[model samples]
Target: MNDSDDDFSRFAWHTAEQRAAQGDSRQVADLAVELTHRIEAAAEQTRDHEHQLAHLVRVLAITPGHDSLTQLLRLFTRSQGPGVGLAPRFVASLLAEHREAADLVGPLSERDPKGRLDELRICLLHELILRGVDVDAFPKTIDWTRVKYGDHPLVWLPRRRSPLETRVVFPSRAINSSAHPGGSVLPKEGRLDPPTPRTQERSALVDTATLDLHQMIVSAPEAGGWGHSEAWVFRADEEVEPDRVPALLPTLPMGCVEGLGATSRFEIARRPADEIWSLLFATASIGIGHDGAHGAFGRLWAWKSLAALSDAPADASAEEVEHHVQQTTWFHFESDAEWFCNEIFADYGIAALSPDRRRIAVLAATATD
Candidate 1:
């Protein structure tokens, strides 16, 4: 099919997989059964009933749990008359009498490899965070080999020969924009510098003790006609400890400071931290796919922003929350610099001053012109 069709199919498949992954097995099963009936009904009108009937049978066979088995049998036995042949009866008998159907049909054992890997990574990271493992230590515990090369056939030989050597190695040093700031297409002027040694050290400490740190820069409207922006950094599922924050503030690279602190003129208000560690983990794992590669820093920053602000609802599923964060981040990045500065800061309770006596006439002329 065409690219758009392929995309739509992939999206639908992913959506279904996501629903199934989120412990909604019953809902998925029900939907599958409903679709099977609809297809079967349509097959009756068409000349190619055999293929559609077989497809329906396959659907029933694969559906998990005893409830699905019962539904399958009921659908088969109820449609025994007329053109409905011995195939349904045979399948129904096999399902009803023996354990073969039970063995064949069960909960989803296999899944999309990439999706499964993502889930495993998120879970692994969550467990590591809970156990107070250092962020630096993450590279050691998780199998990057499986993540990067396990599924690809090209590296299969090397993986089979020496899995350790084949594994993708993450750099020991903090990601530095000066060295490799990701894709060439990215705007260099807006890029943040690499993490300083001090920042890296503190980040490790925070990761080991609490949660991962994330930083984002947004332009903020200032007094006069000019707009200035500063980096807003915060930890996932953590509050800014008044005593500790001051010392750590300097560790960040130049122009990288807490958004609230700078906007409130260093008089930031106290807010309790939200339990959004899962949301953070999900967002970080699903980075924005750019230049055929995903940037880790961007994902982390998005995660941190969502977590720090407690933007996701507690009841929302992990997939839903991640989608929301990603959509918001994409929009923010796409917005004009000035609009983003004014809107985001204001939403987060940061005050921006209106332009003073400096240029109403100029502004008026510019607006009119």
Candidate 2:
């Protein structure tokens, strides 16, 4: 092995040996947490992630518990989906032996889980279940096997008005302002909580996971240029009352939208649901495709995100998502609307009413050069 690899391996094992010899559980745990950042930083700098992660997993497997695992997840709150590279297999394997490893799940609001670290955590959670973690171990709120509300966000299919009329799942991460180009893009108190419109279910069991698209968002070098990611789900129940389908949603940007107001500008008219979701997947950059030779990581996240976020079965497919979307009327926001050319919103976005007509999932994104 190279000098750096030897250094990494030696440092991890030596530290573990020293801590274990001293019989200090707290020291071991603290070192475990510290190593995540150290190894992660080394991996990023040397671009040698696989080997680094293997060593990290080896080191952490010896020190298992609720705190270390919980802290490990907190690291994902800011990741952008595919970029975070810890291997889920090792973590899952460790969790299998330690019953308490998956005990705590960070609040979704805390991390807003945009990348693969969250995905990896989810895969570990699912694997832990497979490894004998009790099915009852997870909260009733997070049904990893079921895709609730709609795809991409909201694991449970709560009543339509809930997210809109409920309390903020996450504290206002930011105050509203036109200067930052508000709307569904940046986090607001009433806006759907980060990752999904979680007005009603802000307290998601322990507040945790799901996301992976059935179709790929034909990727481009600049399509998902570095930027912020946001998603929301709103519902009014198509099977209910006197036509209040579009439920008054929070402020929305006008890039993909044409008119000045949100009400009638980006209207829908029943198009193929999957087609539109492809657009959302593209803009949201769900399941990024950059994984060396293992095909695209998007496909992996599709099922992993599903398993991680809900109780929905592992085999949930795109057709089913379409079945739900097609049940309503969906349409695309054209490129000819009033502010369709706005620079801020111009990066990317998908504003379509779910096929149920009872909800609208507004996903807005911004890209920087």
Candidate 3:
């Protein structure tokens, strides 16, 4: 097929996958079953053509390692029909079934078990957060396979757990504020309880783990303005004067706010520290992408502004959040510095904003150096 056809095909495939993930049974069943038949056909053809070394290489070249493995598994259970795999495709299904079952549960015995285990754990954790589970109440551990509901392993549960967890999961270091260990959460009373200051203030950083997207805009305007006309602009560097920008620099700008002229706007209000953490983490993990590595690092750079703030609290008063317009190693595209500012402002509002603190500090440090 041509490039356009290929693009369309990929989009269609991804659409199917997304729907399946969201529990669209019809799409999941149809695609899963159809894909299985294709896989079996390819496998049989490969086996028959193995005698021709050139043909084998060609077959292998066209099939990614992950695709080949998935096909093998799908073929084994073909008799159940195409739609069947959707019901019991992975360990999460088992957990959902027997969340309270009594049995020894462990990660499945699979090739590249570590990778599989991590995916499962992340999925479960995200699932929990989405269900409004207070992530802070449960400390995170890497023992996915060891989980048990009563006596049965989590993988073997007959029914999914009730009351799914809803708080988004993110890397712990992302939420570690200089204010305290494991970071501090503001109570509903609007108190400031930060984590103990870090020994190396220079290293303090904020990221997806410490920010919450939902809470940031729950009652705010739909789009945060960047003092620019372009809707949905997110820039690291721009032509405008630094003083004119209205949001955080060096962070992902909220396109929804800027581009769409969202009616939601930031409000100056006290938010629970836990809520802030959940929003950032959820945005970084879920809203970014399925393969969110680039987004993660982009978030890390955004946190660098926070790090600068935390590093020298004595100097926080002199800093301003800065941005470099040119795309560097952080992200590949051009962004709107103004939009970035709007997102941060929309997230926290202007009353409690601290954009200038980091800017002042950076300038002072540069002068000293």
User: How many clashing pairs per prediction, in order?
Assistant: 0, 23, 80
Candidate 2's residue-wise lDDT over 242-285, tens digit each? 12322222233323332433233333222343444333323322
lDDT of each: 0.30, 0.36, 0.29
lDDT by residue for model 1 (1-369), tens: 133646545645776788778898776676666667767878776746675765666456445566665555445335534115424322322232233322422321223243333222332232223223343433432342244323521111111111111111111111121121221111333222223232333333222111221121221111111223232323334433333433343333323232223223222222211212222222222211211111122233323344323334434543544444333221111112222232311212221111121100000000000
In candidate 2, how many clashes are counted? 23
Write down the worst ten-residue block by lDDT for model 2.
169-178
Residue-wise C-alpha lDDT for candidate 3, range 171-200, written one tens digit per residue:
221111111112112234533222222112
Q: What TM-score should be assigned to candidate 2? A: 0.31
List where candidate 2 sits over 4 angstroms from the true fold: 1-45, 48-226, 237-271, 280-295, 300-319, 334-346
lDDT leader: 2
Instruction: Give the Å shift of residue 167 in candidate 3.
Output: 6.3
What value does the lDDT take at residue 335 in candidate 2?
Answer: 28
Estimate the Cα RMSD of every predicted model relative to the unseen true structure: 23.6, 19.3, 20.5
TM-score of 3: 0.25
